[model samples]
Target chain A: MTVTTTRLRGVEAAPEADTVPLGRRRRWREDAVEAVLFAAGFVSILTTGAIVVVLGKDALHFFRNPDVSLVDFLTGTVWQPQLGKFGLLPLLNATLMVSGIAMVVALPIGLSIAVYLSEYATPAVRNRLKPTLEILAGVPTVIYGYFALTFVTPILRWALGARTVDIYNVLSAGLVVGILVIPLVASMSEDALQAVPRALREAAYGLGATRLETSLQVVVPSALSGIAAAFMLAMSRAIGETMVVAIAAGAGPRLTANPLRSAETMTGYISRISGGDLSYNSVDYDSIFAIGLALFVITLGLNILSGRIVRRFREVYE
Target chain B: MTALAPGSIGLATSDAARQVARRHRVGRAGLAVFQLSTIVGIVVLGALLYNIANEAAGLVAYEHKTDPAAVLPGGRDLAALSAPELAAVLTANLSPGEVATLEREAPLAERSQAELRRLVDERVLETHAAAAWNLTDSVLDRPAIEATVAERHPDADLRLTSWLSPAFVTAPQSGDAEYAGIRTAILGSLWVIVITMAVAVPVGVAAGIYLEEYADHTRWLNRAIQTNISNLAGVPSIIYGMLGLAVFVRALEPLSSGGAFGAADPTTANGRTILSAGLTMALLILPLIIINAQEAIRAVPSSLREASFGLGATRWQTIRHHVLPGALPGILTGTILAMSRAIGETAPLIVVGMSTYITFDPSSPFDKFTTLPGQIYQWTARPQPEFHHIAAAASVVLLVLLVALNASAIYGRNRAQVRY
Candidate 1:
């Protein structure tokens, strides 16, 4: 009797639920939701598309323009875009010089910080120091710009002699940018070091190795891939860092190798152009996009390479 | 291994043994060197903080273009006067026509007393800071500074200027470095963050939920999407700026500038509106949010879902009731971190045509805007030395805000972990 009554009630409620296949409405709703979710996920892909199309379209205009020769764009020594000397080397050189100086400053310090944090410090000390490092990491690039300009530039001037160093020199910007990436490298390297199996260290110690010998020989070697990945990531960041270089690296595309002289980076060039008032659709304007394309390719390649190194070479210990 | 060698074992006190001992000594020294390198990073961070702080506080010789006494007519310290008294002084100093125009621009009666006083400082009594020195220089070279002040502007009053004062935070940008403040920029930053979070949070979380709960890992499309998202996360931020320029500032100009919606601000019809900037920022942080949210969702134990399913709940029901709540804290943690990144970002905004000198506060998303970082960038590029102090002050503000946001994120993470 109870089953009959429930069946009757279900039959009554069925029509109110709307006509469709049995449970079709519910299934449709769920499927629609899933589709919506999938579409939402696809927005990220759409962004990549937009980035490529926008950059490619304008860059095509840049390269195809009568004023810009493709060969000259790649091989010319001078990059005076205003003067129609559309060379990529000077900007690329400045970027590399800054990245080189940054690596010199950041690599040793970042690795040391990671080693100390992961291997030497107690957990309490680690907790305290990590946040402190993060404070440095979290500072806005503009602050670092001022710091490079007002503080770092003045110091560099004193050390290199005011006459020798341009007021806006690559070295000052590079040093500060190096400081900026230290926390990133240190944090990533620390993660890599901590991931090294404790068993490896114990095995080394059991074989009469001291703590230093075990860490340097056994653990560091095991974590080399991660460390390498971290350095590459840091290098990518330094190359792309904008304001610090824009403010202190000067505005000219000087093509010279001297770190003490003023030079402009690719990112710096884009920023310098954008900061000013340029008429829309101008070749000079299009050239900034062309520079952006170069920046995008180089950084993307570095990131992919770094990611592969981390994934392919990561040691699994069970 | 060295000890086990035949010669080393036979002659433990010989050359081979000495080499082993020396190797150990060298290893120990290498450890010390590594430790010192770590100290160098810490020292650099400390020095950076000290430098910014010293510049934020300074000594200034103020040469009042117009005397404050003449303006106020009362022997009260400008800082000590009540807001109402300050307003009265402002009323007394400005010509009736000038005050009328100011009121028409933004009514003083409706303004907070602090704002009225700032107006007085700007319009009625012109206070120009001349020959400012950083705190270090102010303390160490006081005599020299004083000598210079005496020689240059003997009539000017000297004061210990903390550039990071309340007035500094409240006033808008001005042509003169002395009058410039980050008020408009701060408001613009808040607006951008609002729009960014509004767009990014829902989309990012939805993507995370789909990837974690609904995505079929066996499917090639899903796998490709997953790879794309991670790669996007690693792309340089400046590239995002370029994307913002071409898409939001140019291609989507009609929508981003509000022309399509028929709500365009005349000044920002070219799509350099706050809306464009906000949308750009939203895209910039989307990958960070999606990645973090996926990790959070992945962390939820399977048992909760199983129990819900066992009770005859559908997939959506189970996810909505159990999975989402479990993942909410983590998602929020990701959002806060994203917000922090968006706040400090300047590159993309600059590309989106963020102004260097916006004085009036933005009224809507369609209006032209600047941000704290943008203002700081502008000031740093300026030739004036006094602008550097204000820029430092702005940096202090930006850092404090970021720290607060990060601290809350840390707190939330800890709390969530404890509950689990």
Candidate 2:
């Protein structure tokens, strides 16, 4: 293919080449352009490498500190940076609570919306509603944090009693984060649902199945892997989410399951501590990097798993 | 095949009919539930906007330390006064040391009328919200609110205040929430976004072009680049902040802080400036832009490339003249959306160390800066209720800005569809 293209270009450019050696010069220029573009593309690889090296290097510094034992860092419950307690459980527990609550809110609602869009709605309805749903995704997370603090928390306090609900409880933060990720879940699940072949639905209908039966029994099951991938991706996003939890979820990390109590996630802890003045190379500063490294690995693992599930389990239809 | 008796067929039974009817009912209920799920998203959106709007404007009871009329000679109207006259009012009301400090910051006579007016508000009148109410209560329970204000603070004057007024947009940040505005934050955001676009667009689009038109999928390096970009897109934004801190703020401090250029801000001779923040944002949004640009380029028909190649056009020539023009609109739409995302991003900027209470606008990429979202985050974190009100007001402004960007992107997408 390359030889034929070069021959064609040479024949066409013979006259121009005679005047100015255009063919060889143009080929060199094309190669240069290709190299430049490749460099641009290579930046992404460099970015990933930078993130790993930066996080990994600082994390190593944090673990190497004699005061912080790796076993205690992972196994201990308390996470007081000032007094030298560097347990990962409290932050990890809070992260899980928030993400769990978010998933509880987002998964069913997102899947339902996907089912509605793919199996129930007309094209006109889908077109109008999809963008409206996207508006949810477009909203800044900081605004969601504000909503969680000023709006959602008030309602929670009014219902759960102001005394029972801390001003910066995890419940409100998680609920708002859940609301924030609904669009992600809905859109991805919708794509998965839409990808299910129409013939499956027709086959179910021919067997006298109800619309719900067809969607739930045939379409959903066939699209299960894709939906699972969506769920995983949403979970990853919730885990990585920063602003909402930082603003609404409490500042101090605590290893507790009670949603009404104040607790901080990994992300909340990072943002809160980093926002304050921390002296360079201090243990406090290095701890945030350690947490960031953990966050990056977890989210990266989930994303890769999500991608694999989608690719490996995708049903190929003629 | 054996023939079945008509009476033995279960399809005609009343029980079968009832069961079928029940199934239909269940289906209808399920459909309603699904529809309700979709509506939940819209409703949450509505609630968020309403909550912000409610806080952005309302009734406030102000407690002024000194009346504006008392500052001026013969009780002249404050708005009617010139810059120097306003400066005189500030000088007359403030201490001698305070006056000297104000003069040192800038010659009081050289200050603009607007600046002088703001100073009078900040220093002379010293007006602050003694009591505040949301728009809902202000409109629906006005009599009760008035009574509460009268009972709670008799000296304070009651009036309606829109936190998101035009003046609010142009005024600089202040220590006092009542006097604070988002001008500096807005300018900071604009500068950062300008730098973000300048760096991200060319690189992102070029990467897209390479991946779509030039990459050989058989090559492992090309495949690795593709996979790497996809993973980068999923990486948490805060991690990017850490990367920026390590790379731009620390490792490349001389360049990022403008020390290399000999233009560093004396107070903040570190890399926590607009340049570092912008570069961080560029990295955060680069994968997004590349993916979108690739899709846009992919949407351009292969036939267009083939036609160009048939005319003996070089690969770069075909891409420059034919493919790029076709993909420009879509690429622009994606870039604008990415830009909007960068504009509203707060966590990364926070990690990159944005000063929460910057009063002066950032004049260059190497200046200490704050963004609108960063300001909102700061205000919301404050203990004072009035700060929350202003935070909501800032949120409204930020939301409007985002909506406008998104609308333009939608418009561009429509135009692209029409052209195709």
Candidate 3:
């Protein structure tokens, strides 16, 4: 009798079930929440789109100006906007000089620190030292700019003589920038080194190899791709760093390789130009966007390449 | 194992022994070099702090255009005077035209003692730093500094000045370095950061949730969003500045300037307001926050979610009740870090047109403003040696704020670790 009644009720419920709401409100709410979350996630993509659109539009406007030729902007050696010379070489050269100096100073020290931290230090020592390195990393770059201008510049002048070093030389700026990037390089390289499997180290030790030899030969070689990615990322950062170079690397655009001479970088030039009172829609005003577009492209390419290398490295290890 | 080369088994020879010893020596040397390389970063950090400290405190030689005693009645002490007395002193000492101008700006009688005192110093006494020595020189080579001051600024009165004193913190900026302070800059930073946090925290967390919880790996749009965020993380900060300039400062001028709300300051009705700066900073740190929050959420054990689902909880309910609480500490850590980064950022704000000489506190998001880092950059760019000293003091303040923020982040991370 109970089974017959339940079957009669189910037959009655089945007829209206298609029209009845079965947690439809809850499902609608869930979809709404997911949509909101998706919108939030989509904002990042919107930001990228906005950046590309804004930079591309202004850069196009800059290039379209009859006085500003794309060829001259890229290939010319001069960057004097006052004389209608929009050459990018001077700024690009200074950027390379500063970044090169930074790499020169950071690479060996940062890698060595990584090797020591991963292979040599006890866990306790690692715990204590890691935060110190982070503190170094957390320092504001504007402070580094101040240090570059007042402290590093004066010391360079005293060491290399006042005449040999200009008050605002790329050497001082680059050296301080190197110091600013040291913790970055060290931490990233350390992450890569720490990711190397311990079995590789044991294998080297099993062969009666010294710790240094194992680190330098077995472990570092295995982690080479990760290390290279770190280097590339750091290089990109140094290229994009603004305040330190703006403060100590001088304000003039000069195409020179001498580290002692003051020269402006692309970032520094953008900063200098934007800081001034340039009227809207002027060639000078739009030129900064063109330079910014170049900066964006270069850094983005390097970052994408670094990400690829890192992904490949992860695949190899995982 | 079969017949090997004859010279391969010569391991116990004296030459081999020497080779082993040399290798050991090289290993020791390399260890030392690597250790030293590690120490170099710490040493550089130490030197940087020391350098800033050296510049922030020192002996200063002041040359007053009119001595404070000359402006006061019976040469009374300036500190002991009442606000009214200070106002009287200002009125008596300043030119009639200057007094009228001051009254037009604000009534002197209504001003606080500190305000009156600042006015007296700025207009009446004009106490300029004729010479300054760094802390190192002041302590170690006092006699030389004194001698140099005496030789160069004979009429100057010499005294020790800590540029980061309470008076300096309370005072507003001035054209003269002797009276410039970071009070306005601090307020501006607070206002900007508040707006940044309000916008970034929820949106960033939601984005993280979407990516970690709702995103399907098979979907190309989700993958593109993921890739785009990572790329955005690596984009140069200055590029963000350009975006802010084009979008916030120009394209959305009406909204950013508060003109849409009819709250815009007529003097600063353009888009280069704190709102624009804060929004730009939010975008700048959004990717960072998203990445961190995703990691935190991903670390939440799957068992918790499984249990929530077993209880018939929906995906949103599971996240809201079970996962979010577990990830809160990690999210807090990331938020603090992003805050510190935004606070220290100067380039984007500069491009967004932070006023270098803004003296008034930012009362709302629509006001023109400067931040500590922006003020430091401006002062450091100044040709005056005195400005550099104050810039160092401002740097010290900024560093302390960052250290506090970072310490809290570390503390939060530790708590998160203990929980799981």
Candidate 4:
């Protein structure tokens, strides 16, 4: 889906300029293509409004009519929707816990992969290594969910005990999600690491820095903003992940820190209750919005932060 | 390159030093570990491809296992099955749940219950309905698998024959595994991506074009928009979902049909409709497309634009004729990468409303639908183990589609790159 649109728009945008150098009528045709292309993209923008406006409006509905008290929604720890009590802390905690777990797990492995690809591996090795990491980027979350549920959960259970992992546990979700985030981090961090100009690294190496030191200090510092954006990207991905958590993470929302436990993140709760029969205007329905709204705010903050970090600080030689 | 060379080396001594440095950089002990991680990434990706392809192959194997007369797609192994033959295969493996639905249609409580039960359940023999259930097993043994499947009940067509299931392309999902397909997910993904391009491309390109052609980088608002777009990329997808939930689903419910699939309340479209969820997903991935597009546009050289100006072309004309084409490949690559990211996105959609089991084909734009990832989520969450295989199959479908998209985009760029 992502690949198609980019290709479509890219193809639509740039063909004529390459083919013909200059002419008034042809330029008109080019502008026409540009206009059509822009119009098409503009249409996408309007449609995109549907996502924001639709969700924003629905979220507003939840805010507009709250059957459950806001305080209860925010502060209450237990979230069993059957009785209609809507405490969001569990969802919040789940989102954070999963994000935290993913970061802890993904950072090392993703950075390692990035380092291996960007710093260590030869070009042939990097070529093979890069796309391998990239393939992870393309694997659907559904596959990851199955892996997490069938493979990861059972292993975690065996390593600890059956009690250590529930049919749907936060750790399992987090673990799978961490695997998902690894590609995000590794790919982006590799870019960030690579973006550290060879000159800068050479300057550092000229000072007698080891390859490891060159990577740790020069490359990392030089690409700090990009790496920061990558972290933010991973965080947003962790927060947004659905299938892994939905499959392996528990549906029950609980506010707690035990990694070896069952809990629901905002997404898990949405998947659980939405799939079940529910009245549209019911608080149970509205609760998803509240949770969604919370998710939106956090990820939006992170996404914007990532963009800013890249734009504000990351240097571009070109 | 010269700076990277280790200093002062006799050949053997240099080799020894290089080996030591190689060992130090990736020490034999840690090197083994690093190698494992590298191998793990490659193997993991390979496994994903192998697993998906392997699982989807089940469709063929399962087809052959069911009937000797079965013909694969694009193959003329055998002609169409007779009606009874279709019925034989469908009834043979019809699950307990499927059998019940078939009973609902045929009300065969006094008829073939024992036979049907034997076919589906090993130890189950209750009453049976002679009424036609949608399918049994592999369905090729009985021609009625095709016959009953071809019946024009709107939802009934969902029961696709294993050999020639049009439902694979057109059907919505059903609770029964045999009847289920990726149609809705495919459509949902298609629609959301289409809509996302609708949303992201223009503003993205305009922003891209403007940043490249018009916007004064010296100004604060321009800078602000730049910062905003970049930040938008970093925004958690759930945030977009929340925004959509708050905005589109809630606010646009009037425009959105309710009683979605006749399940939820009539006034409010169930949270999981395409319009709502797609819109949310669009917002979630908007910044990415725009950023990539902007970068692509920026890659176009300025000299062409100057040449156009020298020839008396307007600014727009110069950009249209001279600049945009130069950057087309880059922009396409950017959008492809962004689309990959969007397709992989689940967070925002979850926040807004993507469901696991949408049994109806989403007919209206306002109609609720489930995507592959969403359906896979439903399947994987089940306590039953077979659902894992279903999830794997769906994953393969999604991956193939994404890769196709990515590859085509790259191909377009590479092909055009020769001209450049």
Among the numbered candidates, top DockQ falls to: 2
- Give me the runs in candidate 1 sitting further than 4 Å from their true place: A1-26, B1-11, B14-21, B67-93, B102-121, B418-420
Chain A TM-score across all models, in listed order: 0.92, 0.92, 0.92, 0.85
Write one digit per residue (lDDT tens) for candidate 4, span A83-109: 766778878888888889889888877
**What Cα-based lDDT does every candidate model obtain?**
0.87, 0.91, 0.90, 0.65
Ranking by lDDT: 2, 3, 1, 4
The residue-by-residue lDDT of candidate 2 on B1-420, one tens digit each, is: 989887777656877899999999999999999989888878998999999999999999988788756677778766688997888788877899999998998999998897888788778888788988999999999999989988998878888989887778888998888888999999999999999999999999999999999999899999999999999999999999989888998889899999888897544747889999999999999999999999999999989999998998999999999999999988999999999999989999888889877788789899999999999999999889999999999999999999999998998788776254
TM-score per model (chain B): 0.90, 0.90, 0.90, 0.67
In model 4, what lDDT does residue A285 have?
73
Q: Tell me how far the alpha carbon of residue B185 in candidate 4 is from the true structure, in angstroms, after superposition.
A: 4.1
Against the hidden reference, what TM-scores do the models get? 0.92, 0.93, 0.93, 0.71
Top candidate on lDDT is 2
Which 10 successive residues of model 1 chain A have the least lDDT summed? A19-28
Residues A1-318 of candidate 2: C-alpha lDDT, one tens digit per residue = 997998898799877777875445667679999999999999999999999999999999999998898899999999997788999999999999999999999999999999999999999999999888877899999999999999999999999899999999999999999999999999999898889998999999999999999999999999988999999999999999999999899889899989999999999988888888756679988999999999999999999999999999999899
lDDT of 4 by residue, B259-358 (tens): 4355445543544567777667766666777677677776666677778889887877777777877887888788787777678676566656676566
**Candidate 4, residue A284: lDDT:** 72
Worst 10 residues of 4 chain A by lDDT: A21-30
**1 or 4: which has the higher lDDT?**
1
